[model samples]
Target: MKKLVLFVTMFIMVLPVRADEGMWFLMFIERLNHRDMQKMGLQLTAEEIYSINNHSLKDAIVQFDGGCTAEIVSKDGLVLTNHHCGYDAIAELSTPEANYLKNGFWAASRKDELKPKSLYVRFFVRMDDVSKRILSKVNDKMTEAEREKAINEEIALIEKENNEGGKYTVSVRSFFQGNEYYYFVYQDYTDVRLVGTPPESIGKFGGDTDNWEWPRHTGDFSMFRVYADKDGNPAEYSPENVPLKPKHYLPVSLNGVQENDFAMILGYPGRTNRWMPSGGIEQNVKYAYPAWVESSKLGMDKMKVHMDKNDKVRLDYASQYAGVANYWKNRQGMIDALTKHKTAATKAKAEAEFNKWANKPGNKEKYGNVIATLNNYYSKTNEKARHDNYLVGLLRTSAFAALPYSMGRGLDAYASADDAARQQILPQLQAAIDEYYGNLYEPLEKDVLAAQLKLYATKSTGYKIAPYVAKIGAEYNNDFKAFVDKAFETSIFTTKERLGEFILHPSLEVLKADPLYLLSNDLIAQYRAKSDEQAELDAEFSRAFRLLVQGMREANPDAKYYPDANSTLRLTYGKVRSLPKDKRNDAKVNYYTTMKGEVAKYKPNDEEFDLPKKLLEMYEKKDFGRYADKDGYMPVNFLTDNDITGGNSGSPVLNGKGELIGIAFDGNIEAMAGDVIFDKDLQRTINVDIRYVLWIIDKFSGAKHIVDEMTIVK
Candidate 1:
């Protein structure tokens, strides 16, 4: 009777409410979403979207570099993704003399393609529910630790069973706050090569100023090709490897989008905490994000100082600086939007209702304390959360702060090894050490580390601080420049030559005594330290939160529900839509932006908004060719109601007939709170229209052969 009630409750809860407000699993679309999608103009069947034994849309989508999404656009594995998604690889291949990032590069033929040392694209093969099998191993009486162990044992077996003798990678992911489980299988191709990109002025057009804001005119797309062995199996970089023959590739559409025209996006969205409680929301908005914003700005300011003076320094720190700036802006936006929306108060009201439902006679045992547990956990950890985020900022921006932890482990292994083992490890260790220093610009690094250390030490005052940092703070009065200078001068890890000598005569004593290593160890230990009582409370809180979700589903029987995103493939459908008219946008209609608006933002020789002379000349001459919209303007970027987040950076936005229309990249600033709560009115996905991508490749870059490889449908 109880099980039947739970089933009926879940069925009612999952009934569609808002059409544009979910990141839905592909596996559940047929039962839960297909009818609504069809009504909204999805011409493709659910089977056509995902099929294990057939060539389908799922075959074309891949997790790019384990972080972002990309799609195979040609039969020979020409992959399309956003420029920022390919930023690291592009930066790796760039040099001061022949800088591809400053001036875009297009491979004339397959022979000219450049490969990065480490880059991979993973194709999703299949997925299936394993909830029943895993859940059978745990019971209500079991502790969270025991429950975790039991589930992990089953997960390992399931992964091993499905791996098919090492041919595929398998992952068992928990969903619905551990209420369910599913296993995903994937195949990874490691030999992805860069084919083309726009110059930074176009690829990153508006830079930090225009990021996450609509009226966006950034041409934020890049191209790469996946290579495989002769049999079409994944392989490492080899001269003889050929472009992969993909199972399915999207047909690019020449027909432009109009308002209310049905649209959909598919990608691996990284994460969303839509199920997070009010206390957690309050903690992040009030405490954690503020620290993140401040620390990130500190790092960016210090890096930019040296980066502006030297081309080599700029090249070395470009990727890092861009990364820090993006999140710096994003966190501050979240703080503002959350505050503006009063998201915490809204969540609290809902929780108040849930608390009443939970305390009712029949529900008291399972859910009565769930809300209290969550509230207690958040309140206890608020200050620590702030402290941790500050530390996280340091870890992200300072190479030396993390280097001891990363490289010192190898040194420890060498110290303990026999003579033969030491010989085997020495070359690999030496190569890694050399690679570390090769990319590092020491003077800029010192400035960044000093600035970040000072910020972290001075600002992270709410709780116990890292002991070494505290000592340094007291000695230097919270300014770290002199200490960082002295440490850099004395630390063996500072240079490749010193590290090489230390490796020859490895000693645990020397590593322990090194000031840099000691500092790194102390920082890490402080972050991880927790009392036994706190650990118990955390465990109880985890169990209570999962029950809270389950109980909420039962209590709200008619409310809509979907699992939070966990870096898995999902499909979200909506339409090409517009918001209320705003003067910030140059578009007469708010749905799209054109080249004229982009050109208007340009400044002469400016880093963020500069335009190439050729581009400006072409725009002035009205030379967009066939890529222009029906209105005779060259569309740069467009807005849609499709749902997206961080990992959806390069997702393909498809029209009703499953034809590629645009590449989904950014989200509007007004809806920065979308991750915590979906706002149907304000949330919009900002995308670079496919036509703009083709215009740059065909007419501007003269890479017509590359465009010719695609399956274009008018």
Candidate 2:
């Protein structure tokens, strides 16, 4: 009975489709609680969000990769998103001394706020179901690669035909790997400006320690205003730039969430693991997260030791430390929660149960290695993820906006680079660096890469980049004496000088230089060159992944297959629920955390639990403004069964009425398996309600001009 219950629960956690006729009857029942998602929010008509045949969002949400989801909030060209999302823009315009990320940023007055050099948000001008357009070019007789090539050729011809001399980002999205396709034309404007953001202590709040876990109170958002050319066309920033009047905007809500209300998050969620095979789930439990969790823990321990014994290295990798440390602590809870739960063993049993019902004679070959194949893919995915993090996060993820910084880095390395040009890019890079790195790039690179490499080593046997990384890692980890000695050749430092002198300057031009800093840049440049090759590799990976998907389909033709996520609009509905994490209910508390629980758990000096003084004051005063939910004390944590990934951050979480209820942020601990498999019980998304955002803006930043643009609802 115990094993049966566990199996049932685990199967429900990962199932994506809600259907009664599926091979696994239990997967369908698990989705019953989340039926609200099938219909989306009650407030929204189906036509308002997705084009029924198109599987895309209606022209309301404009997305930018600048860590934000923007909406044309007012007809007067005003845009609204989380405040932290706009921090990079503000930082870009700030100076080293200006330190925008530390102080929180505000436009003060419109003329005073700095404009990002090349910031922009994209709205979908049109999206066509180009599936037929390309598929027709190939037939069943063609090989998989041949099919893709034919599709690519057709797509290019169609794009050239349909574009009619207009500019937009054209992308072809594939479903079920190569099963289906679609194309979109995006109107990308290059001019965007920083409008406002709360202080880091307010916006970041709990910071790294609290990331990904609930009872969460971080505002974790940013704000920016988009602009248009004089001709009402999207253009670069200019003195004459005017605010872009948007065609549509999401309305704010006064009626906030209470217990068990249905909610849905809508945005390009970055990634999720709703489709891992049972074996993949087992491997993650047995291998992936545990390995990563341990590495992160050890890396952070080393970081702490460095911080305690050496100030300069600590300061340098502050962001890196925060990031790795945050994930380390955060993931451990998830790993613990996942391992304690019966998800893996139960999933394997469920697969076996499904096999009993669906299996025919000689079926093993059809479903052969289904689990093992998924596990293999899971092991290799991190290599691509690490390579991407190195580029997008540290190097050029924010390229359009961070171009100046990237260019400046190039210029700095080559000293003869023009100052006038460098001057143009430097101010932007300087502030962005200050805001992002806090001038801590050198040490941060060492820390971030060190932790990442450790994980890479565990996941892939012959990881393509291992040879390159091993060479660097060995030298870096050898010891303080050897690492420092070999860090730079013809160096100037002696055993006598301070760490800062060695890092901040070459001791007398050659006294001390570090290989890590120079190598970090080299890796960045090296990877940028390899990125295209990676894309080709990814295309191959996708081919292999799709073959597995096809194998799964052939094994269970009736089993529904969802398309790979392409940062396009998608709607995944499930019930608001909690998972049972303990093996046998030792505590009797089905695990989930909330605001009251969060407040009670708060520990003053603990880095993760340290609340901002201002927030604490608000709580003390019972200053429940319109922002407070019926439960009181800003409903800081809420959950939903929205299938989301990274791009989903800042997504507008809506209730049955389509009213903005929460801003999607992190996934619950049970869901960390989400990067591999979303357990229905554990797969809830953590969101900060919209009311808190309004309250924070109205109360914290006091930005009335920005507030007035919204169509507030009660």
Candidate 3:
């Protein structure tokens, strides 16, 4: 352990600490980061935070639904996560008569707790450094493909040997752009159930307008309970299963946050590319994000028109709309923030410095041409990148093309099945088709498909189009609506009834002959052709990227280097603070927001700011209960400098004493560039104060039963 610490510390000894940057590996924290954290008021030791030999903080954290972080808060395995993390589950449970999304839901008792069809939480078992094992099987002389195959083989062997007969999910992930590797083992619990949630008016307060902005008052949290078998082991969901007895759970702290207080967050951060070259950043900003933003906006606009008018439609498409809107806003922020911060120019300057170092003395052989190679690849594929984005957007978001492709494979399967097998699987296939059409709106989709097809046919970003494009031009005179009208008239995928009629007497030839299916097949073929053309360039870029990351570290051995996040459990510590307010904005930035601010933003019947009448009465009465701070106001949300990204949503924000004070939810808009390059002065993590969460659960919702389950520290 000492030796490992020394090796990590040696690399970062001379590095300047810029706003306490780094998403550090837990295993190395005791030796490499404990002292710095302690100086910032950390009261827990590294082992106490992440010991494998004993139950520690690690046992409390979980990978929620394979995408977000969640933590156990009670002895009975009560899990806490972002409201958006549980959005799909809540939407699934919703109905026109009882919309849990509009009005909040609180399971009055354990029996009332609802489990979604599929929801799971994974607990981290352990992680191991397997760099030497992976690197031993390959040499520098090996081609990139050969090296990848050899490494994968080695990783499979390691995972197989350590799986303990499949009791845990084991896999290896590359870190620092494949300069290092680590193996992780996790045990998943599949019986997670929803316990409580506030309404969208609170949970999704401010909506898209306040999503990534500060002064946030959104009570963005939801609750769940993890269940286990009779013996307290992980098991499938069953009525007989009982709430799990967790190994450890966080003690919630009611102590309010102050300016510059110590803060820490631990979670599975999805991904970041702090080591990306300037050329890649430019390509994303200039080519990729614009198409993504435009397509997502168009999809959201169509969904909103239907959702606003019909309650059933709103419930059916709520989760999907939120997902699209989140990224639509995020991509815009990324483009604006990156360009505003001059990230590409900064990266270019640094790349030049690294290149200078690489060309000096003995470094040339190992690192030569890495920068130029990466730049050339990005430049050569710039137009193709935009074309691919536009194509993917049309196929994925444009349901006319998307549904056929998604359901076509299943149709083909049914066509090839024997009579006995077909009878057995027919019901399942019918159910799937029913589910797809249940949420689909043909009128809206037809318009969307027509618009996207017109764009695809007219766009000059790419060199080739799907084969069906020629037919649209030659036969329909480039009239996308005319082409769509004929396809919908003939394709079984246009309506659920048509699909059902075709399924009654399935034919492989007829299915293949359908215009929509042919279009789907043609789109796939075009995608494959483009992929094949770029295959070699992609490989070259990958090799160059690996070398670039390694060369940067070698060139600046004395600078601190933390591996980019790859959805692995990590700890990032810092302090509570606010960024300097932009001159263009009139509102003064505050470190924390309160219930007063939430009320101030309220609109009586507005979709984004509507407040429940009961809550409005409570607010008018100033009935904050016992959760109000010393100043006699209920806290809503706060800001922290703790380094975090997308997957860190719902991660516990801990005080120096290792007590949960808040839940990390979003990042500030000005620092959207942080994922590409950490901005010391701008980046800030937005968190929902735990006090606000508890207040909503206890006072507003009247679910004191939940308050009784937690270990509260006043």
Candidate 4:
């Protein structure tokens, strides 16, 4: 079969990498990587890095906003994370008259800190390997469904037993394709407040144009303070709450860095698919990612128009727009880099080798069919994945549909409730509807829905396309614009006033007759119809993947193996290094970018390149301050060979002494495919130098009081 050859080619061409590459678990650092890390300049003991019984580096890091990593910088719980990590909270606190997102925000004092309705930081309490306990319940003889159920049940029981009567949050995660399992315990603090942030010009400088590019100049950092009850225990936000006094915090290092300087990062890296097969990579590059890129660009285009026109809309949509635009560019890079590297072909060759090992007489029953099975399934479902992407993208852009879909559940509850219950719930429903309308803008939603609906009707097929969308298209003679016109003109969901009037006297009959409500239900139904089939296929793929990886590890027992990232705390270490250039690309890159370089990129009034007047004045005067490196130039950003992925944003980049020197924000463009395959020669971790963060705080923002809290060292 053609699939067999592709897999064969992929396996044969796979190359081994030598540069530092891994997101290693903390518990195994001593036995597995401490020696190698020391050879590369690690000065701390493995226990010093992640000891459970004593204060260590692990105590300083927290998972920020359930996604990114952040580090405590002061005894009073001041936390440092990437600017984009806190963008959503900043946007939430902004107003048209005093837009924090546009002008930036500073607390000035602890008393002035602004707390959001919901924001939390989680501390890493401990982690334990539970592979034997979990695998004791699962075996190769069981069917995929049975294996999954057994593992889930074992994980649930282990998690429940370890929670300590609901005092701490617990989770069990699989690593190395379920060959290993670990349980993590966490303590969550809810009363977190915004401390400060730079203006969009400084924080998000270079925007999409320089998002994942090198020679970077973005500040890309923000500050927040965690709070607790007077006794220093985690509690809900209240006026009586006080700043938390954490067990450990990182001291800022101003010693500066040079090429080959030791660098390490501690953070929660979200996810990586380094072990995925050639078939999977081919599908993502050829089918799935292209659709995602197109739809995301469409959504970003629509949002930018409305955001540029209105200040209020800009503040509300700033976070949403950045999030969409980030992935839009990332997906395009993935496609380009994967194709250029011949990634799929390389992976197929590797699969060929795996097949030979898997088909051995002793291993035939356990692993023989995994490659063939995965290839066959990928072939059959490639188009469906593309269709699903369009459908998901359409819903993402249709913001109005969310209100009806979400509120419809509330209304359904009301319809089924007794008279007493209705009296109790009506006011809550009213408040919900009011809040929804507060953020909704009819014209924006109408335009977005029109674009998405047109794309869906023309490009999608089978049960994937919502039936209501099809009906509207047919009625309007395939003119989605005209159909949108009618829907906006007559739909109750379009106007707050109309929706409010209906909400005053809620009933199931009125909702059933409403076009938007009916459409919401139809989309939900269509999405659910595909869920069961997808889950079945996913189970098959997961089981095959587990067997394949397990077998490979056995066949090559001497090889060094690290788990793929899964939003769990991990450590990666390497040295500051410049990327080696090739014939296809020869852009000269330095190990660091300076303030002069940042000013050089400036274009007055340009959204992505503009700098503050004060920044320019300071730069012109050469206000190097004490934070400047010995060369008399202030470092803005630098490069490292550290392996990292998405969730590693805002992670602390530390030196051998475990002192914070920079914050990892982005990765090099050539290494965009690093998530799927670690490239030794090309991959680099992009970091904002700690000196820049302190300069912005002390000189640019004039917030030295906050700076005084950090233990800065020369």
Candidate 5:
């Protein structure tokens, strides 16, 4: 019940997410992939990740901060997405007595459908190339730090002054390391509501058992409806939040998946970093994430002990509990995969080849041990950085933390250091905090910020915090400072306190003189600057990747050197596969699940299994119709490891023929390293095949009318 309420509260608050494509741009480098573009295979001269300004497909791409992606599968506001993507909604609309996790939610009628008070989805209306304008001030001579800032400021200014209006999702992204920028205009709908979900047995069936493994039988799909005001304007939730009348929507596919059938996932993939040195890779294999899993497991166990004793703490911490459980399970899987398997060894071999070539020429001195240096950095930083959060969060308050969050980068707006093109973004950046701040948590969020800084002090600087701590007392917003004690006389305390004090109360003269702070200027400047820097680093990394790719080409010219994901609408083709961890653990992998499994996992022969008795009879019949598998069985969905992360949720998995295959949800635990590398051999995408979803609509809920609208391919 608490999970339901918490999800409801978060449902209303929306979030933002990025990708790329062009001709002169495509032809610019006359290369398959360029740093100017993010998709080039390894060992190529391509610069960095960039959007294709002239591609139709690029413009058609959209992102939602709602933890999922959807495509217009119909003329109405009906959206096609993954089941796990809609988990929170399903939970919110569920009742403890009904426990949607055990059964599932199926709106008997449009009016009866469960409505999530604040559910929403973003539609991509258009994308604008604001690059030339963004980089007008930059040059080859500037320092890396300086260049990064200039590029950022420029992009922010562009987004601020001119926007696509509030009806849609909007964001600006920098690509190719200060080489380019683009603004995405998205149509946002507030009328999104729950449409369907498989019982947890099917949707998330297998629970922790099959996550991140192959030969998996996890049904991972869900459905929702989008509503709009009668006037076709974006509005808050209301009886007025009518069903959305959409321009486009994806259809539910009933076609079956076969071995080696071409498949591609189209959605907002979270992230990928294929440029880290072998050293960093080794850290992940050794202590970094492994230790993290252990620590998280310990904390979660402790939390559970406390939770079992007290219900309020459980309710307050349920979200945290769920989160920690999820992370612990997933991270453990990843750690096991890295250590037990040869994925890291594969990367090490590739780096060694690059080292050989680098040594043959003067380049060897420049790039030879780059991998080692990176690994060294990883080894040195991981332990301290991973554990620093506890210190930071436990000691500081949000207001105190904001000071460092702002200026931690440098002097001057990073983007302002460069060009007029970059300057164009200043106004846009200036308005960002005001635009997005309302969507963020300010106090509980402070805990995370404090934790980050606390860790940084102890880990990097070896500086201890003053025992004299401060917090935002309930009475005065965040003005309460317990730091008014003598213990802060220590050097480290004095240094940190001085910085904090200045930030909280900058010279009134400086504060007033600054045009940025009058508004949410600080946040605006920070994002803009960081965004640009991110682009620059990615672009540089692309170059390094090319060097690595070259070695691969030399080693196996026939093998495909897949490019890093750049949030662009790209396709990855793979088949449903599995991992045989051990004899006893060899698991069942499938496309969908059943309530029976959920009952077995939890209530077996118990009162909970009777949810079906209360449900409509039509749902009791296993008539899965055309959406059923070839085995004459109903399926909910299946998961794959096609190298995806956060943003990939709700992404449509398509076949090689460009047909929808499944909805991408997550990467199996063995695939978390996907953030920095794509393990072609093991990275899988969690997908809910459309056929299983159709079964829920046609057979389970007698909602054939909903499925009728889709252009089901097979």
Candidate 6:
């Protein structure tokens, strides 16, 4: 423990902090960043940002639906997050007769708010380092598996210790490639309900064509309210619950932004690999991401064919379609940006320099083979990486491909249960079957699965392919439609009714002989299959990676570093910034965009670029309310240099006063390689200005009551 503290102190003393390059830990704000942040125009003290004993800015932020960030905006628990973040919930609550996703909906009063089947928001309570305690349980002499087992045992105790007898949710997360550990405490409220949203035409204005691009105009915000019992403690959904009065809420700032003004973002950033080696980068850019892009596109194309022709089917698959399209574009962008910037070569050069230091006297025994092990592992797994990504596409997009694993496991358990146990599990299995069939549109699912199977079987030739799929593909002349069609026609798992009949007389032999189940089982087995040699290599690779990160820190004691993001609460600060002048951006400067540019992209009846009639009329009339800038234009979106990534969506983009100025939504296309490396000059966080969010809610949607709930700062 003493040694660990000394090493941490040495690391801090040598860090030459870069203002715009790190996702900082809130707990270390005072010791590591407060002074630097103040120099960059922060007005509040570090204690005001994160305080365990008092209500602070950290109290306002939440992990929305366990994926994206959100913030409390009102004393009544009005929560704000990105439209796409709330997309699944909104779609779930919508129907053809009352399509809230298409026409938008605002709760006229508290009783009018709509609740989805499953939704929750988690507030971060605090975090503390548990590294020394965890690491003390393992040593260098232990194998990786032994080390992992020991760590897991300790982690379970740590979580139990902090959970306060089930009142709080606790997670022990590893950082710096498992060199360090921290436990986060959070409280979750399950009775969250949708408050309001704009029409799809406005909420998703630019859609796919404009995603991850600058000079954008998308009102990408959604509102929900958290409810709790009268005592303000977490509880399940019930009509007796009321709006939660939160510990803190951010005041919406209408002061707007200009270039160089101070801006910061706080959120749970998902993941990044800034310390990844050159070989790993090469594998992703050259092999894995390309397969992911191609397979995702194939699935999207097949689904869209049916979605375009039927409204019910479109509604059923809306959320799934959006998720696939977003990643498809993102992965392709990553490939382009990483290749264009030669990120792999850059990492390789750095590795060469580190290798020299690694082989030196005292370091030779501990770190000499680290680089070789990593390189050899990546080289050997390159083809498998590509193969796995293609299969990942199938599992993500095709329900049937994953069903045999997800549902079959449940059935296997049920079949093995005794009579008394079966009575308890029968109802739960029925509900699961019902839910699965409820969301599925058979024609769309069939088409997508067939197309993806064909694509995967043909493109995954570099490694061992799924035997069942391969055999069926060859029998069908590499076309899987007829085979998939026949399987769907005969498989009991294809429909709720057939599955219900099977539940009455469960049989393991029937499940094993099922065509669809056989195909799905083979695909899953192939993906998980690993030779003994390969398994050993993987374990060595993990150990070597951890050592490489630790060795680099020791070698370059003067360099600055932050742990890579792993879905933990982080803060990043910078300035309202712009990119190099481009003909594409219609803004006067590239720092911010206006309503005029959004209207310019509008098409009368197009899906992606369509605009509502009321929005058009308001834009033409120049009926800009107080939400407009002093120059008489409605600010739509703005740019900032705050380092962010995927899970940062819906994060509060706050001004120096800790007031909400905008909501972080996307990153620029030029910096899509940001997960691997940070580019201070080109990387920008795209935010929908807070004023635009208010205007849509109060003026366009007539939800003035919602605005009244917030403390608006002008």
Model 4 C-alpha lDDT per residue in residues 1-714, reported as the tens digit of each score: 975665434433322345378888898899988998888888999989998899999999999999899999999999999999999999989999878887898898888999987789999999999999999998778887898799999999989998998988999998888889999999999999999999999999999999999878899999999999999889998989999999899999999888898899999999888888889889899888888888888888887889889998888778878888888888899999999998888778778778887898998888899999889879878888787777777777777655677887887788778889988988898788777777766777877878877776777763357778788878887787776777677766776787676666667787777777777777777666656777778788888888778877776676677878899999998999876533222223477888887888899999899999999999888886888878788789989999999989999999999999999999988888988988888899999999999999998899999999999988
Clashing pairs in 6: none
Model 3 regions lying over 4 Å from their true place = 1-16, 424-428, 528-533, 581-589
Q: What is candidate 2's lDDT per residue for 1-714, written digit by digit as tens?
A: 975665445345434544211111111223332343444335554555554244223355677644456655555566656544565455555554665655666676667656765677877665666667677788756665687788888878767765658776777676666766777667787777777776666566676656675545666666777778767788777879887766556666788664456665556544444444555555555555555565566556655665656444443444455556655655566567657766566556655554443344565554444444445555656545444433333332111113332433433443433546645655554454444443432343344344444544334443354344456556566333344335423221111123224324323223113344444445455555555555555554555455555554554464344544557655455445445453322222332233454456557866445555666676778775777655454555456666666666677776676666667777766566555554454466777666766776777667767777777888
Pairs with steric clashes in candidate 1: none
Candidate that would win on lDDT: 6
Please identify which of the two predictions, 1 or 6, would achieve the higher lDDT against the true structure. Answer: 6
Cα lDDT tens digits for candidate 6, 1-714? 964554444333223335988999999999888998899989999999999999999999999998899999999999999999999999999988999899999999999999999999999999999999999999999999999999999999999999999999999999989899999999999999999989999888899999999889999999999999999999899999999999999999989998999999999999999888989999999899999999999899989999899877888889999999999999999999999999888788777766767898999999999999999999999999999999999989999998866788778788888889889988889889988889788988898898899889999889988888889987999879999999998887898988887788888888878899898889889878988988899899999999998997887666656888888999999999988876766777889999998998889999999999999999999887889998899999999999999999999999999999999999999999999988877899999999999999998889999999999998
Consecutive 10-residue window with the lowest summed lDDT within model 5? 14-23
- Give the distance in Å from residue 226's predicted Cα in candidate 6 to where it truly belongs: 0.5
Output the better candidate (2/3) by lDDT: 3
After superposition, candidate 4 runs with Cα above 4 Å error: 1-16, 461-464, 531-536, 580-589
Order of models, best lDDT first: 6, 1, 3, 4, 2, 5
lDDT of 3 by residue, 1-714 (tens): 964544444333223366378898899898778998999989998988999999989999999999899999999999999999999999989898989988979999999999998899999989999998888888888888899999999999989988899888997999978889999999999999999999989999999999999778899999999999989989999999999999999999998899899999999999988878889899989988887787778777867887888898788778878988898899899999999988888778767766766677798887878888899999898877777777777776676676787788888989899989888878888888877888777777777777777776666346567778767766887898898888889998988888888888899998999988888777777777846548788888888899887876775566656788899999999999876654423224478887878888889999888888888899889899889988888789989998899899999999998899999999989889878877778789999999999999999999999988999998
lDDT of 1 by residue, 1-714 (tens): 965554443333233348988998888889888998999999999999999889899999999999899999999999999999999999999999889999999999999999998999999999999999999999999999999999999999999999999999999999878998999999999999999999989999989999999889899999999999999999989999999999999999999999999999999999988888889999999889999998899889888989999998898889999999999999999999999999888788777767777898999998899999999999898998899999999989989888887788888899889999999999889888877889888998888888888888888889878989999999988769999998888887888888888877788888878888888888778768888877897898889889988887776566656788889999999999999997877888999999999999989999889999999999999999999999899999999998788999999999988899999999988999888888889999999999999999999999999999999998
Q: Pick the winner on lDDT between candidates 1 and 4.
A: 1
lDDT (C-alpha, whole model) for all candidates = 0.90, 0.55, 0.86, 0.85, 0.50, 0.91
Q: Give per-model CA RMSD.
A: 2.9, 8.2, 3.8, 3.2, 13.2, 3.6
Model 4 alpha-carbon miss at residue 312, Å: 0.7
* Positional deviation of residue 317's Cα in model 2 after best superposition, in angstroms: 6.0
Cα lDDT for residue 272, candidate 4 = 87
Score residue 298 of candidate 3 by CA lDDT.
73
Q: Estimated TM-score per prediction?
A: 0.97, 0.71, 0.95, 0.95, 0.63, 0.97
Tens-digit lDDT track of model 5 for 1-714: 964444333211111001111112222333432332223112222221123332222222235435556665665566666655666566556554666645776666778777764577766555567867766777656665576688778766666655644444567775432245677665666667776776765566555555555444455677777777887667777775677655434444567665444454556654454544555556665645654565455455545665566434434444455555666676666666656665566556656555555566766654565455444445555544443433322222222233323442221343234555435644554344333342233233333333333333333333222222211222223232221121123211124344344433434444333322221233233223333544554445544443444433443354323334455433343455544343322224443343334333443333222234432243356545566667665544454434466666777765534456676766666666556555555565656667756766666656788777677876
Clashes of each: 0, 39, 0, 9, 84, 0
